[model samples]
Target: MSAAPLTYTPLDPSGFEELAAARPDVVIPIEQTPAWIGFERALGRTPLGIWAYRDAAGTLVATASFVHVTRRFRESVVVINGPVWFAERTPAAERLLMDTVREQFREHPAVDPLYVRMQVATPQAPATGPIEHGWYEREIVVDLTPGEAELLRSFRPNARNSIRRAQRNGVEVKHIPREEWKEVFATQLFPIMQETAARDGFQAFDSSYYETLLTVLGDHLRLLVAYRDGTALSWLITTEYRGYSVYYFAGSTLEARSTFAPYLLLWEAFRVLKAAGNTACGLTGIASENYPGLANVTTFKRNFSKNVVVVPTTYDIPLDPVRYTAVASILAARRKAPAAARAAARRATGLARRVGRGRGAVGASRHS
Candidate 1:
């Protein structure tokens, strides 16, 4: 008998949730969920397309979510960690997805994407070559299926101790919903983000960026904050989908270091994920051999799970003639510019500090 024809349709929140409910065993990343798409939309990004196909039983069994990002008018659609489908529906879903995406580029004036970057979350669509657009290649996935005793035993000795110590020392990790978090997030946690970015030498998003993030993520997002003696010490944002929860980049105050608040924060998140019936939790990106500075961070992730998963290579497949080459060339240039930019920034900051110190000394001597 021939395979049943699949009808593809745009996915709303309810439709996406229906597919999510249908695929209980599959762990679709939160980035491909409806809340994430809505979050992107709130940030002024266009949802290029999101489609789900119904199975013969009339259940939504497959999903493909894409977002349009325009950088200097070089537009592209990125399928963030998904194009999720059941194993049986892979072939039919793949054909419909490719056809629909191509149609969007060709016919839909609003979706004139220069390229399509996809990393299908299925065994059927394995990626190859270099990743053009992605957050990380390797991520740490911690198994949460084991009992609490087994989970603690799996953790590194130091990690286990830190969690105990944090609890004993009155360092609390609070799971605040979005609405409740607003009471303290701006005043207590926002500055920590800037401090973390500066200390780690990374560029951070604007203050307004958090508005889109917190508001649009809805219930899929969690605000985990570590506090010591009534003072906030660290903050972690976690997102859940299906049976998977992912830890995003977080911030920690200098005062939190002595208390080992970061370690405790992660443990709290792990506990919550396990209680939610999640089988695994992603410790987000970790350093491979390429980034030496991240050795310590990778070691921390390893404490919880020895299994480090490398997502398939994200390839940039061109759809347009004019902007694809332009964007590719720009990305190539940026790949080589980071180290030089860091060096320049350090030198400028050092010079500015010296100048300020010299002026301060001169003023002191004159006043005396």
Candidate 2:
């Protein structure tokens, strides 16, 4: 039988949510959710719209949400962890979805994107024609279906021992209410994040970004803090949608190392998410050649589960050939130059810090 013709159409919030709910077993990526649109806006990106492909029979087949990011001289539309498929997905359907979205952006009155970068959510073979772009090469997801005891037993012996040691040290993990986020970020989470960034050699986002994220995501977000002797030791942020949860953001203090507070915090997170009926929790991305910054945390996360998941690579579709090619060339040179300079600066800064007493300094790789 021939498939019914599919038409590209705007998807309202209610329809988007209903289609997402249709696949209860599949965990929808937070980037493709309606809430993500608000998040992009909060981050100063231009929200295009959420769209879907519907068949003649009116069944929604696939959907995606787009956000326009204008960075300095470059402008591009980004689709992270989408376009989502609600029915059996094929290359033809995927191609049609991508083509139609590009058309939509081209016809958009407000902006003309230099290119569109799409990171497909489904794991099927990637569609052809778009230039392949890659971000975090792999991620780790843990199954929460097993009973709590079994879940705890599944972790590496080291991870299990750390959790136990944290408990023995009188460490406690607690969830902070949304009403208290601002103050907590200022007093606890931000300081811990700074410490973690310094120890790990990375720059942390400003507190305003997290404040806005908590404000916008609201109940869909959760903050878990590990405490020992009435002092904050470690903290984690997670976001839940449908039946899926993600280990969104996290940090710890030097004091947390001895107590193993992060370990207990993760164990408690598993129990809390399972109790809330989430069947899977994405530990987000792991260490990869392209993103070696994750090395430290990846080793930490791997002690919990080894279910490494390889996600689809991103594809870039050029809308304006002239500008796209020019920008691509400039970006290639720009990337190498800045990276070398930054590495040198970091080394000098690290040495200076050792000599004296100085201090300094999302998407899949972004948040991970």
Candidate 3:
């Protein structure tokens, strides 16, 4: 009448696929893992992954992974992203895994102030234990079960108008073949992304990383290109996760903005999701608070659906509160310095260019 003991193992890259398939609810897809891995690689960081196994009477009952974030400023938190366990073993397995992770984290000085962030896609919140609590995170979800006409009617007036204008203006939208799209994206979108990142003060992934993703996800990933009068205007990359399709990335030319090519591209993506029998679409990563231009972005997304779910921004549980705060403040300051420098550089460059142009004009007039 004794309970069975639990076992823990370090999850290797090879084992992830099989484990993920065994328990879909608790596991994120293989494609998602690569994206995260690619993110870490690009940033020059590595995360630790620990897998939990429960066996009762020599029979395997459950499995889960404890993922620890490894970064210079944010090294203390170990996020338990997508832990999978069988339905029958939920309570016991969850408790055991949680306890083990807490103990493990306590022993390691590197992992102080440990916290696990888990996202359940359903509208209803999951039960939380003594160690865990729920926080609000928002996402704009569009129900795709309805026909195209119904879907269009569900949109707000502005969204509908934009869609109409895009259609009327003859902005053609279609899926680009993966191989061909890769080439086009590398040549056309990469430079735009680099410029945007430079202006916005962030880093962007290299083209090879995106190409790898498109190759792995295949049909589940789509590249929607918007064109007007035989000229490419904008493009959007979408990925399907579970029953929902997400608008992952998009890029548009300055010319495209005048014709509202992005509006047409998004409408086409939604239509494609509906046609493919997806249940919903996710307008991902729109900031809800404390950022300029975020409100405009949020408002634009809100027009498409009534179900606006806000996701919690990234959280931190500091181990050394005093030290952590000091480091965090320093990092924040570092992030701002680049933007200020970029702004100053731009102004100086503009002034120099204007002065040079005036001198050139004056010289030409004198010669004439």
Candidate 2 residues 1-368, lDDT tens each? 64445678777789877866676765578888889889888888788888887777887777778887777667778887776777766666666566666677788898878777776543332232243344566888899999999998899999999999999999999889889987898788898998989899988999888888999998788889999988999999998988789999999998899899999998999999999989889998788765778888889889988899987667776677667777777777777898999999999998988766432222345445
Q: Candidate 3 — which residues are off by over 4 angstroms?
A: 1-47, 50-102, 105-136, 194-203, 206-209, 215-219, 290-293, 318-326, 329-368
Model 3, range 1-368, lDDT digits (tens) per residue? 53545655655666755655666555243224544554444444445553545555544444444345544655544343344445453444545544554455557655554244443333121212212232324668888998889988999988888878888888888778777877877876666666655655556788777766666556578888888887777887887755667787776666666777788789889988878866778786455442343454577788888797655333333334456557667777887899999999999999999999999999999999
Summarize candidate 1's per-residue lDDT along 1-368 as a digit string, tens digits.
54555556787778667766766787777777777777887888888657766646676656778888777647777888766666554555554555455555566666677777775433232222222546556778889999988988999898888888877778988887667766566788889999988887768898767756777775777888999888899998887777778887588988887788888899888888889977888887777543445665687688778888986436555666445667667777887799789989999999999999999999999999
Q: Looking at model 1, which ten-residue stretch has the lowest summed lDDT?
A: 122-131
TM-score on alpha carbons, each prediction: 0.78, 0.84, 0.65
Q: What's model 1's lDDT at 366?
A: 100
Q: Model 2, residue 204: what's the lDDT?
A: 91
Report the number of the highest-TM-score candidate.
2
Candidate 1, residue 236: the lDDT equals 87
**Could you tell me the TM-score of candidate 1?**
0.78
Clashing residue pairs for model 3? 137-310, 137-311, 137-312, 138-309, 138-310, 138-311, 139-309
Q: Put the candidates in TM-score order, highest first.
A: 2, 1, 3
Between candidates 1 and 3, which one is better according to lDDT?
A: 1
